[model samples]
Target: MLENPVLADLATDLPQAVRLQRLAAHLRARFRCGAVALLQLEADHLRPVAVDGLVPEALGRRFAVSQHPRLAAILARGEVTCFHHDSQLPDPYDGLLDTLVGEPLPVHDCMGTRLEVDGKPWGVLTLDALQTGTFGEDARAALAGYRVLAEAAVRISRLEREVQALRTTPPLRAGDDERGAVGGDADQEIVGQSAPLLRLLHELDVVAASDLPVLLLGETGVGKELFARRLHRQSPRRSKPLVHVNCAALPESLAESELFGHVRGAFSGAVTDRPGRFEAADGGTLFLDEVGELPLPVQAKLLRTLQNGEIQRLGADRPRRVHVRVIAATNRNLREQVTAGAFRADLYHRLSVYPVPIPPLRERGNDVLLIAGRFLELNRARLGLRSLRLSSAAQEALRRYAWPGNIRELEHVISRAALKALSRSGVNRADIVTLEPALLDLESNTAVPPAAAGATPARPPAPPPPAGETGTAPGPLRDVVDACQRAHISAALGRCQGNWAQAARMLEVDASNLHKLARRLGLK
Candidate 1:
């Protein structure tokens, strides 16, 4: 039935792999009486890629590929195969399926089929019936029909394989995968498995399930604010608005009014009754970034509201009650700040009730490349590049670079690379784009030596300049201008932690102008 072109197109066009997996699951309903499971063959094992009639937690388990004799026999022949428990199936594979599933897969009730393409095993489709002697010749033939549908399903939903590949990476346990129209995969949002990050995410999961205040501590660009917003999304108050206030951005004169709201005539230029962030986030979360930057006097008032869940508008006689979950974040060393008398210790303690510390990207081995790939995929789409791949040389450079700015740096580099590739016609397919050499050379000239920070980054010797292009003849002012332009763009990017927006702002130019410069300079 899936071979009908209409059904095939619909399945192929489903934007998400989970949806396609669910489509494959529809076969369980078609077969009526048998449990169905789709298994993808990985390098060393067969894993449950998608399934129906299994317990929820069992959806992601793995088993040895060699554990099933019928599977071995079927794979060897590249054809449909069957087994009966009453037939005393041979050693190693015998009783293996029962052990794998934690139940007896009755001989008379089970049949397995291989999903092969070009005579190679891609996956397996297994169906099980509860009744003894339930599956006969006709039933097996129907299963053959289902297997045909399964192959079509696989071809139609190619991205399902990508999703399965992603699942093999141990997923973050912090937030549930957001699969609805209103949200994307929350798991993809929080990406890491380092011991510190994993523990932090587990704690985040617990905190997200509650209405308590959560404080996040990390260095700049470590994604503390992002995590604060993620907490809001996973909470019961997700339907409500999440209001953000950069405590450090507020002026000392206006900080109180900005947070606690103000009544008409409350202070100088207080012309009207204005609701504060507390009011704006009533029933939701108030994410206060740079919480440590909040002044001392303002801290007392903030603590009062956290304790009482009520705020008194400036110049207002009565206090108004508000329901808001506060998620505070800071890049500063709050404990030290509190010790030094800059931050209020009591307020610091209150905000630090359940603190989560995010690790820097350099510490997340291999994740640097994962994040880079994600950003590349996004920027490639945004920039309208049809096909793009990171050359091995580029990948090596990326892995070697110490990402001080973490995920943010990866995003900028990918965006820069994509823009560079789009503008330069042949760079995308080359063994190594010229951009990397430029980037490396620029780094050699401008990068602050790690020795200054008392550490050194091991770097590969940069590629030599192209033949006949190394000699710098004294020439027109245009050559000098071109060299100056390349140097400035690379420096600005490094200084801004690879943030295009910030670099553009610092250069007093628009982002498009910076993109043009980056393209001309080949600073990918």
Candidate 2:
């Protein structure tokens, strides 16, 4: 019975996170359900705290009470709420299940029980099964019996959190953070659980509460904008507006007016007096994407606003004070720009009060799959496919390939492969579609061969050195970088029997300046 295991867990001094995850997994096993999720109620949405069988992105999703009728129905009652297989209301887990068959889930039995802690709504426990009629009266009663244990688990988890908070003053837990919020969109959520991602999220959570000007530093397509929004959400100004400005997309002629507003006749396009992004984001966050791309003149004006929380309209007589928090992002090296006199030094210091470096996708091991699951579901729904899954080879291919384009590149790869899989060999949309390595279109351009997609190197490869000293990659940002980052350049050299020129050729470089570019990437 769950009584023994649940009671034993309560007795053990387990960490709060471990306890909740165990509870979800145990419940799924107990009921023999296809999936189990424990969702905590945060304001108006249900956020998954622990999930046993849902997609990786499932944890990142927030189900608004108004949007998800089944969840709302479950939360409305104290007892177990069973949605029979035939119920018409939508199931949010549709097309997101990772089953043994992995076919599209047709009719399924699903049930959930609402949980409360200290007289407040805490969360809900949900179970789903592939077979219809899997949830009978007995199952309902069993879930009802388990509800008490679930609530106890949550209550104890809460107490543990309070205790831990007093000890460490912790950041928002990953499962509870709404970088997933997403504005209620699942795609916007920060979707990974790697140590790098968790560490970054924790740092962001702590920094978000402050009024400091946060600068997000990362490669292109690292979702810096999403992190900026998360900082806004975690800050005191969440209820206020979050205005996003793409400095790179703005014209140099109009950049100043666009950011600081303009009086009529200030420029050709200026028609009337208007407030700029600072005014729009007053009492909230103003995200400056590609801030390095801002014109030098505009950067000076931005620095003024950052110094005094005020914005002066172009052609206006005086500056008006505004209370706005700035969160800036850039893929460019502002320090180098400062030294080169292209970017202002004072502006760079003002924006980078707290710089958070988001790690690249390759460094976030196994997180690639979780992110792939998200895109897979999106494509599945978009393509009207019953199911879309990665073959083991395709998944390995995804992992081994150096994702220089980062998340954006991965999105394109998945979308293109989904389409290719649909058109190739007359694969039916009604059937389960498994994407193979060839469909991914990665190996030809990437260093990893399709034949050895998942193979491990025989020995521990030496740390990669600079790329310029070795060879120049004739390949498009691959061969050299991918070999260095994913595989080892020394291993390539080893394969060439310690021949530098041969290794350079194998890495697809010019073999002249192969070992320097990596130093630019902080690799020694």
Candidate 3:
């Protein structure tokens, strides 16, 4: 017990934090008490840091600051409020302690000291006496001596907060040129912060400063738009507008006019001259979403613009020059499309000047929580939720889900759950303080819910097999081997949480070789 000299000196000397939890354990053994708990106050809250002589499982459980009446009275006014028994105290925490200790805490004999440092309430150091009338004034005074060290620990915390505040500055305005040079929390925006995502962010940082055409390849709803937006924000054209066009949404009849502006009376609908997306996005960026959906004819026009940096308005003879960077996104296999004559080989080469592939949510390690936290903050007010938190079980559920819609799907789940809770009658906003397992329950049960009424499914890509291979019973060795290899890498990536090195190690290949295979298989 004397080995905890650090704690003894802290009561008078340097006044730093000392656990002495071992000492508390020894004390419990010597005194034969039901429980001995150390509750420390920090950051304006009373947190239970250590415990002894009680259930081992409840060791790290915490009670809210000043929530328990007896503890509150002791710390608030230096009055040693006594609990005759656990039943008399009103169950503070679902009665875990009462059940664990096998009896209500002895009220008449139980005593604890109000730890006050520099005359301010810091914490409570208590020893519960199970027998009747076993504690008196002497015990409270003995525990009070530990206050000095507790105060020093609080000082250290204050210093650390100050240091962090100094390091993180506020974001710059959109108009600021500097905003384009250095992005606003680029890594944080990426969600996962996993090893693969970190490396991806590093690559983004290196490429964002240039005006290179970036092709984002990923499965549907894998946050390609977010990466494109980040790229625009970090580029020299940050101040310029970013125009988004879904190539798949455009009708073939008007796709050309929509892309490269038309002159007056070019067609029946062209009553007046109109600038197309190319002209509108002059000196900015044009994000061609679902690039593979562009008709072959439209693809030829797009190729010309990318190659020549010029656009010719419809019904006009001369071409007009426009300086605009292009960012294309596709969930389709462009290489297969090229072979099938659905997509232009020339356009593919032009758009993929710089390609960045995004991994799916299931492959992103622990990003489920990160995206969940961000979505909660963003939609809390819109959903009319006062306070919310994810339960441990709910967090586990979110981690387990393979989010087919990626970050977009996660946001929808949180928004739908919060709104549903708010609409419930007699439920006060404060009552909905935490998002429990029930909120996540709605997401997993149904693939599509009435709550997510208008959500469109992401269309699957076309087959990669050759026409002959599809009819045959089996393909050649190389084709079957390639199919198996892609499936293996994709499964391994999901299992390893997008850690390329670990996935490579499991596959027994060099990391560089794995990278080559991933590119060939299109498993990002």
> Each prediction's Cα lDDT score?
0.60, 0.75, 0.62
Give TM-scores for every candidate, taking all chains together and pairing residue i with residue i.
0.53, 0.71, 0.53
Question: Which pairs clash (backbone N, Cα, C closer than 3 Å) in model 1?
Answer: 85-107
For residue 22, model 1's alpha carbon misses the true position, in angstroms, by 17
lDDT of 1 by residue, 465-524 (tens): 444586754433544555555555445544543344555777789766766655444332
Judging by lDDT, tell me the better candidate of 1 and 3: 3
Write one digit per residue (lDDT tens) for candidate 3, span 1-524. Answer: 53255355434333122334544564455445556666766543455555665433233234444445666656665655455444354322222232343432323345565765566676776666556545545544444443344345444544554464344323334666544533443232455456677777767766877889999988756778778887787666777778889775676789999999899999998999888998988988999987877878889999999999999998888999999999999766677668767779989999999989887787887767766765654454445443444555666888887665566667767776676566667767544345566765533322311112112223322334654766856544654555557556655544443345555777789876876665543343
Best by lDDT: 2
Give stretches of model 2 more than 4 Å off: 11-16, 32-35, 39-48, 53-140, 155-185, 424-426, 444-524
Flag clash pairs in model 3. Answer: 83-107, 84-107, 389-434
Clash numbers, per candidate: 1, 18, 3
lDDT at 357, model 1: 76
Name the candidate, 1 or 2, with the larger TM-score value.
Answer: 2
Query: RMSD (Cα, Å) of candidate 2?
Result: 10.3
